[model samples]
Target chain A: MNNALADKALWDLRPGEAATVTGFGDALSVSYQGRVMEFGFQPGTRVQCLLNPGFGAPRVYGISNSVFSLDKEIAAAVFVTTRPPQEASS
Target chain B: MRRVLLLGSPNSGKSSLFNRLTGLSQRVANYPGITVDVASGPMVNLPDTELVDFPGTYSLEPISGEEAIAVSFLNEALADDHVSHVLCVADATRLEKCLHFILQVIRECQHHQKPVTILANMSDVIRDNQLQFDPAGLAAALGVPVISVSAKESQGFEPLVECPAEGAAPATPPSRNWRETPNEILRGTAQQLAAQFSPKGDVLINSQLRLDRFFLSTALGGLAFFFIMFLFFQSIFTWSAPVMDAVEALVSGLGEAVVPLIPNRVIADFVADALFGGVGAFLVFVPQIFVLTLVIGIMEDSGYLARAALICHRPLRVFGLTGKSFIPLLSGVACAIPAIYAARSVDSPRQRMMTYLAIPLMPCSARLPVYALLIATFISNDTILFGLVGWQGLALFFIYFFGMLVALLVTGLVSKASKNKHSEQPFVLELPPYRLPTAKPLLRNAWNRCRQFVTQAGKIILAVTMVVWVLGYFPNGGADLGESWLGTLGQFVEPVFAPLGLDWRYGIAILTSFLAREVFVGTLGTIFGIEGSEENMLPLVDHIQASGLPLGSGIALLVFFAVALQCVSTVVILAREGSTRLALSMLLSYLVGAYLLSLIAFQIVSLLF
Candidate 1:
């Protein structure tokens, strides 16, 4: 239960699993599932891991980095929690 | 002024984001029919900036029926002067799928010289997953400033929000030769791409994402349809309730205040009956109508209405029309005029006529008052049996179910003889990438519809009410309303339905409802001669329950309204779409169906209950 997978892991990392973040911020490539655009989530976003990350184009097409984008003005209403506090991060 | 677009694939959480950004700053349409307003919302920009939330789509390449709109929009904009700043929002988890669209948009926008940026939204989600993002690598490759942010968390706003748009352009590819058939080009490309990338072998074996699959597409389409429809119906009831009551009170007070000013008994009654019961009644229902139109406007602007037409196609086709014909049927539930015009999307002439003919069978809002009133009086609060079938408030649901079923039955019957039969146009739509839904487009759509409904239905209902009033007015000047020509006309018809257990009041309500279903309850309210209205519908029904009319007659009235073509506007749609003969047949068929169903239902229920 501990390598301590996070909520972002649920989007990019698998349940009861973990992955390392090598870099801080390079606008994560926004894309889709089959054709998903996983850019709806803001910076310091959480994503889950699909397959062991080595499957098909994982970086380009994984549910690991999930986010929803609304119409331009509508996107502003969203309030993302800044990277969860170390104690509160699950 | 500044401009930007929010774009991403379906269910990528784009719509939820839009709701949060603009809360009630939107207006439903103030105009109708001719031009559709898509980009019409204001966002508070830092000092000064403009935001445009484009429709959602899978890729610039068209995929599903609804998604096709984005492709066409992009293509059309390429030809026209229309252009805006682009924010290509990609999901952190599904970057590959999202990149294709981003690449396509970049390639196109760069070619058009439109300013654009890339947003890797849902950074919080990526952070939660312990995901790493290389902005330098992506920025170098796509040639657009990449900023990762979350629409839900609103993170990464400092750098990306209100940031200056990069003037550097993207590299473009050669255009295709259109003189050659589109199919010929598709065939050639399919053969070419087959050689470079392995369409098979290990790549195919490890493929987790199926770009060429139907399951994913259909699931997205269905989910969008369900979510949008669920929100629409819920909003209609919740948003409109308070406003509707306020409207009712305004007109009711006016009617009472004006009543004492008139001198003669007949004139005093006429002012209350004709004005309050006519125009006043119509105004009372406006709030519900406005709310329904606003929800519909949002669905239309977001480009989901086309998806609904696509999803509801199969079920509607069972009634003899294709997916293209489904909107008219759904709109028929709202009101019929728009439903008929909506039938224009159906290419098959016979299908259009059949849809127009059958739309009247569906109960509209006008009929709701009639059904509610009738159900209250005859159906009893308690359950009754109908020849092994249990009838309760459940009978109410069947009334609608029966209308939909009859539409199918009629369409099926008509389709058999149609020489115009054709295969369904496979619903290949471009699911517009999710974007913030704005208020301007929603408002414009609502207001336009309001003007259309008011001008169209208003005049017809008013003219008819006046004519009806005149008919009951002169000669002896209706010494007693019961003695008027209209009253005598109603009482004369009462005996014909006596077998179903109705009296003269029931006859009057039915006759008046033909003008518009809103009048049915009003006619009854006036007939009972009640002073001051009850917010509750039950008290009136309680009185009817005590009246001599049998339970069977009450139930019969409901069933008839449920299945009958009571709304005249629906008949107008039929005539306008096809011919006088066609409209007449639609009317005849519904009247006959109504009589037969209610007769059988009443007879069976009377014996059993």
Candidate 2:
């Protein structure tokens, strides 16, 4: 996949897909950005989408050996570059 | 005296470790942010040393009010001269995230010139998964003492207990780089250290994900959540019925055995009418409090509460609340004071306010005696499902559900009416791994909560009972209670409740209950005891039935108790936690709303029956 196609919001990844966190989106406030980072969502961190409870509910993501449930809006503010399917599977 | 500050990320088993080291039960649970306040206790072996447990936080930079409290107190404690050691607890299974926090603490401790030691908790969990964690290697790498301990099994506590006495070394000096951000540097360091020392494998996360697939799924999760809530209310009545009845029997039996021995009629009347009849009626419901606390403790310990919060988020958002509010709302079932304290965990101030509005409406245990007495009088104890369920228990369930429903509706309307429709707060909740709740700590917590209820509320109930007894007994010497001082006062308030088809006796009970919800039961017990012509004591439920109270009035009483903000402690707590204006408005509005709603309920029930 092209780099443009791989770069998207953290919420865009499906379960079993992996991504490397690039940076935060502009929509997240300065304070919330700090909070997201403090929760171990720094650049270069690997995040895996774990569970997606349907109907736009918060989805679970695994980061730094801890699981966190983030709603759609917050998840969208976290920008990540999705790895290719083969690489994610590996 | 020297002091040790116990600190860590939320759900790292920090408070539990503190309890083990200090031999104090300070309410540890599986859920994060359980300890809202700083609790200090003396170390078991070192009598002169104190161990202080701060509220859990993910970072020195706080996101919520509770974390802010932990951070602020940490700064103050580090500055205090009496502070001798800093113990940072980290989860062995999730060391990367914990190490991030540990690194922050080390930075702070180093600046303060205080010694730091890391307690890697949950050793048993890693061992169970056959995972390896080299604490010695981590200690060598981090340049601080790393002690492996299990708060659950009480293992490796000897080293932990003696760390302060041995005077563990401070962390290695910080090597700063002027270019990069400190957080980024710390994060990078934590990532590397955790990769080397943390338990290898994805066993824990994989297991948690398997459970989440079921508990957080759409259709099945909702069904399971409702079923668990139904069982919660059902068990409160079903499990405590035998214990409640035993308490009732003991009180009356003791009254029978002891009251007659007093030669003076005045003292005997005081003992029987006030002590046994009044306070004893409230005491009968203490077991129900135990059961309520026990059930909540179980849910909190099993780690299903966070999943329940996640499940509740979408629906709760409709009412301008978040899934995080679910914890405090559920804790409201046990008591509103702690529930208000728990609201600190909710990040959004607006949603926290909405949670505060909803908490007082949750059917608390204080209202249990009133509901149980009313239900026992009005609803028949018919058995169904092979006696696994009772009609009375089902009635209790509906009352609880009704309160929660009304709370949501009120928040929905208020949120819709309020301005600022676009300021949405983020909802990021951590899902702690599920663990089987141990029976010992749960039972001990339940027992301690029961004892607290008896001691804290007991004094108020006893005082109110005495005042009511004296007011009703004087002038006529118990011959005619209707002409006594309490009777006159009740008559003055009779007009207020007359619309709901209730008499002055119920009026007085409702009025006195404003002091505390359980005092309603005791107040009614005293009035009924004085009004009864027989010498032997009868159960309050029987007294209600024999008094010829209308069905509409009984239903109205239930509605009133369900809606009213009767507890003064809840009001004081709201004032302390939020604002005095919020507390007073809630108190007045709920009082009027309870009256009007109960009147409507009486009219509807009267028309139906």
The TM-score each candidate achieves on chain A is 0.24, 0.83
Worst 10 residues of 1 chain B by lDDT: B197-206
The lDDT leader among the candidates is 2
- A2-90 in candidate 2: lDDT tens per residue? 22433789999999888877777778877677767666676666789999999888999997568999998889988888765445333
Error of 1 at B263 (Å): 7.1
lDDT of 1 by residue, B486-553 (tens): 88888999886767777788788777677676666766766777533234567677677677677677
TM-score of every candidate relative to the true structure: 0.54, 0.81
> Which candidate tops DockQ?
2
Q: What is the TM-score of candidate 2?
A: 0.81
For model 1, the stretches where C-alpha displacement exceeds 4 angstroms are A1-90, B1-227, B253-272, B324-354, B380-391, B417-420, B423-430, B476-479, B528-543, B572-584, B606-609
* Candidate 1 TM-score, C-alpha based: 0.54
